[model samples]
Target: MKREIFVVADNIFTPLGKTTAENFENLKQGKSAIKQHHNAALSRQPFYAALFDKKEFPKEDRYTKFEQIVIASITDALQQSGLNTSDEKTVFILSSTKGNIGLLETETHTPELFDRISLSASAKLIAEYFGFKNQPIVVSNACISGVVAIITGMRLLRTGQYENAVIAGADVISEFILSGFESFQALSPGVCKPFDKDRDGLNLGEGAGTIILSSNPKYAGNIKALGGGISNDANHISGPSRTGKELSLAIDQAMKDADLSIGDISFISAHGTATSYNDEMEANAIALSGLESVPLNSLKANYGHTLGAAGLIESIVSVQSLKDHVVLPTMGFEERGVTRSVNVAKSIAASSKPNFLKTASGFGGCNAAIVFGK
Candidate 1:
């Protein structure tokens, strides 16, 4: 039998929640983390984005903002994990789309501050903070990086090499990201409306979620990632296919791993990027999975789009939701769009204890999904 994977402990998600309990409370209350960007700080750009309020963090001019986010997220996750220095059985993995973009900025425009923030530094700082002796694996698979990290951790644990591991994913707002997406014309000017008929584009977000995983019975928890899948469309790097073949295969594989059929899945967490192509592709894929009408929600509705960190944050949310026997609302979904089927928008209630099938597709033809349990 495949060893079971459970989220032993997790901190209150930030930028998404004030604390874990507070966040979970909001999820139970059916409140959403997504909001309109009213801050005039954003340069005159068409795309609005979800920004973490860093004022709550310790005021620091020395470290980059991305570094601050990393520290905050990782420390909180480790604290919740209740891991001591003696817990040598744990491994570490870091995933991000834009690692230390602020550092890259400094390196480009302000060389003096460049030393403090770098991609390797991002990984190193987290590993050093945990005082882990093993080198952490760093993955940057555009948007699917977070789910990839969890899958990698599962493989490691399955190999009987480690008993526990921490998968921490973080990213932050940066000038480069705003400019890059704007250049691609993928940025939305206001709050995103995924699967909505009038949906224009995606609004970027900044935040992170960390999960502590273990096969040991000691770390009992509410949510467990039962299993999931990954597949690439290869039809287009940025645009999704009308057929949604790659994504459908991923869902099928993930269900198989969890030893569940499509009928066993009670709900789904759609990638729902709000872009016309992405949303339509997801709907088509869900229909292809033979889960044409499973209850579904999009974390992008709550967190904007966190890019690489997206999968992990959404996965954590699904775990919490399943555990609480509640479903989060699809915040910005206003109307149905042009798609085949399987676009869910509801404050769902579980008939049989809900197990969420979370799915995502990213740049470079990468797609991933996981089946998580209560």
Candidate 2:
């Protein structure tokens, strides 16, 4: 028999709120953290984003902002799960596109600073802090890093290498991130509108999310990591596939792995980045998967695009939706924008659905899909 993986506990630490319950309540009330900012250190031009107050997260000499948020999120999750990290079967996985990349903005880069920039180095520090028995794993595969981390943890548990996996992902807004998005002209002028005709670009956000999974059925909640699939189009370094066939392939594989059909999925948590190409590509992929009518929503407008944390934070929200028996509306979505038809959620609705498909696409033509269910 296949080892069943259950989501034991989860946490969402964002500008909207710290706990998953708080964040879900805010989403239910249609509140958003995105707003205009004039921080010169981040960007010369004004931009919109969901950012944490500097006062709340002071510059720590011991840990960087990236590391701090990850620890905070994982700590919350671990507390909720009541799992002992010192157990030999417990493992840690960290996901981020830019781990301490902001350290590069310093005037003088020392060897110690250089070492701090390594993702594995940060992961090790976090693991040591919690006295984890095994070396931590790092996942930094563009924006899909979080989903990949979850899949990695799930596979590890199935292999009997670990009984419990503490998966956490985080990325903070910095000058390095803002400049890169500005170079691509992907930064939205105001709040982003995913899958909307008027949508122009994306907004960046900073946050951390953690989910704990265990092979033990005693840890089971209403949701579990049914299955996941990942693929790369190899089309462009910074662009996604044009036809969406590659992403469809991934979706197909995930469904196959989960032993599910289109009818089994009640809703979709789309990677609606609100960019011209990404939203269109996702719609095309959904249509190719014969899921054009499935209700879908993008949380990007509420928290902005959270980069490495996007997949985890979004997945956490989807899991919460399943628990609450509600489908969240896609904030800032108006009329449909993509060429292919897709059901963009416009308002909160009650649902008794037991399963949902969460999809994500990122630069480097990478895409991921995972099915979570009762």
Candidate 3:
């Protein structure tokens, strides 16, 4: 028998707000955190993205901007859960594509600074900072990093490996990352409009999100992690599967693992990056799963493509929606664009359902889906 895993507490730090409540409230009003930027080092052309206020962080040479974001989110989540970070039974997991890659621009750095560039090195630093007795674990699976981290935590808790798992994911927008996306001509010049006929490309954003999972009911509060499934189409490195059948399989398996059917899900938090290939692929996948009528929303317009933080941050908002019986609108969506039909929410609506699904896809053909319930 598997142990029940529940998300006891979560937090999000984004440009729209520092706390989850603040971010959700802003979303209710259909406000977007994405904006334009013209950083010379990042791009010669103008770019739009959602970014947190760097001035808010304390001046410290000991930690990188990425580490600071993770610390802030994890600290808030731990405080809310009242979990002992120093406990031997607690585990710390960090999810990200690039940790301190921005440090490479510096001409000279101490051995310690150089070491921090490695994802594992940064994870260990954060673990020691929190006094975690176990070695830190790092997940660097591109955009699916956050969702995969949550799934990893669920498995560990079910095995009784830890009493609590602190999962934090973050990716800062830097020249290293921005240039890569630009090379592919994937960055949008304006705020993203997922599922819209006028949608062009994705906007890169940065933020941190954390979720604390445990088997104890006290920490579970009102929501539980039913099950999660991950798959890869091996179709393309940057492009998604053309068939959408690959992602549908993952969704089907996730629902089955949760002992759920198509009718059980209330709403879907789709991995809608506002890209042409991505939106169409997801619509076909959802339709293939026989969920074309179920209301769904994409949060990219609110926070752009947050990369590693996308899954957890969007999932946190979904939890808030489930708790309040309100479904937030998919900001900037105007008209249908995909070949397959999908019920993309155009405005705020009320829902009475108790369960929701969160899904994401990423580079290297990775796809993941998870079910959560009250």
Instruction: At residue 143, give the lDDT of candidate 3.
Output: 90
Task: Give lDDT for model 2.
Answer: 0.92
Weakest 10 consecutive residues of candidate 2 by summed lDDT: 216-225
Question: lDDT of model 3 at residue 192?
Answer: 89
Ranking by TM-score: 2, 3, 1
lDDT of 3: 0.88
TM-scores for every candidate against the unseen true structure: 0.91, 0.98, 0.97
C-alpha RMSD values across all candidates:
2.5, 0.9, 1.5
Residue 187, candidate 3: C-alpha displacement in angstroms: 1.2
Question: In candidate 2, what are the lDDT values of residues 1-374, reduced to their tens digit?
Answer: 66889999999999999999999999999999999999999999999999999998767677888899999999999999899999999989999999799978974788887887999889988998889989899999998899899989989998899999999999998899999999999999999999999999999999999999999878666488989999998899788899999899989988888888898787899999999999999999999999999899999999999989989999999999998888999999999999998999999998887999999988788999998898
Which residue pairs does candidate 3 place in steric collision? none
TM-score between candidate 2 and the true structure: 0.98
Using lDDT as the measure, the top candidate is 2
The residue ranges of model 2 lying beyond 4 angstroms of the native Cα positions read none
lDDT of 3 by residue, 43-128 (tens): 78888988766687667487778888889888888889888888888999889988788887763677776776889888888898
- Model 1 over residues 254-364: C-alpha lDDT tens digits? 889888877677678888888988888888888888888777878676678887778888887777776667667677777788567564666556546557788989888
Extract clashing residue pairs from model 2: none
State the lDDT at 87 in candidate 1: 64
Off by over 4 Å in 3: 58-60, 107-114
